[model samples]
Target: MLTIEDCIALSGLNEAEIEAISEHEHIPEIVAVEYGNYLMHSPDGVPMLKRIILDDIAAAEQRNDLKHALHLRLVLRHFIRTHRDLHKVAN
Candidate 1:
């Protein structure tokens, strides 16, 4: 039985990124983990996750949660730096 943490670790997404995906897709974190795992292997899914994180940052700002918003921004920055090739097309 893989725990949620294990699933998340395997997906290569941080908690904030996974949470963004969950909220955007209106699914639970555990389900998002499975989806994330799939997405991590797909070219389209990388950009999709980026969009989800942007949406989450916007939502946080709308609620006046600057701290959370800033944190999420940092997470996005790190994700982008680490997964730069994920967004590129072979052709």
Candidate 2:
């Protein structure tokens, strides 16, 4: 059977991204992994994932959690890099 780590690896999203989606959508991490995997393929999906990361960053800042905010920023950068193609069409 596949483990959570396997699922996470397959989803191509890091734990931070998945956790943010779970918190934002109030869903389980596993479900978030499935969603992430699905979104990785759909054109609208990456944008939605970007929105989730942005929301997470805002929440972290609101809570005065600078460390987490910084981490989420890194995640956002990586997400942007990984999905650079998706953004190119907009430019």
Candidate 3:
């Protein structure tokens, strides 16, 4: 059985992205790992994660939480740089 840490390490997603997904989707960290794995493997996963990050950033903005919004934005930017598909989307 794959541990959450194992999955996270293999998924190539940052901790912030995983934490944001887990919190936004109300899922456990392990589940978030599985979701991250799926997204990492799927062709459309990068776009989906991008959309989720945008939503999280929007929510943070709505709450006037500049720190959280900036953090999420940074995560998204990092994801785009690290993942080729997402980099394409960023361009």
User: Cα lDDT of all candidates, in order?
Assistant: 0.84, 0.87, 0.84
On a 0 to 100 scale, what is the lDDT of residue 19 in model 1?
A: 82
User: Candidate 3 lDDT, tens digit per residue, 11-56?
Assistant: 8887888988887898998888789889877777888888888999
lDDT of 2 by residue, 1-91 (tens): 9998899999988887888889888999999999999987776787888888999899999999999999889989988897788756533
Pairs clashing in candidate 2? none
Candidate 3 shows a clash count of 0
Q: Report the CA-based lDDT of candidate 1 relative to the real structure.
A: 0.84
Backbone clash tally (model 2):
0
For all candidates, the clash counts are 0, 0, 0
lDDT minimum window of 10 residues, candidate 2: 82-91
| All models, RMSD in angstroms | 2.1, 1.7, 2.2
Model 1 lDDT per residue over 1-91, tens place: 9888888999998787888788878999999998988988886888877887899899999999999899889978987877877755511
- Name the runs in model 3 displaced over 4 angstroms: 1-3, 85-91
Candidate 1 has its poorest 10 consecutive residues by lDDT at 82-91
Best by lDDT: 2
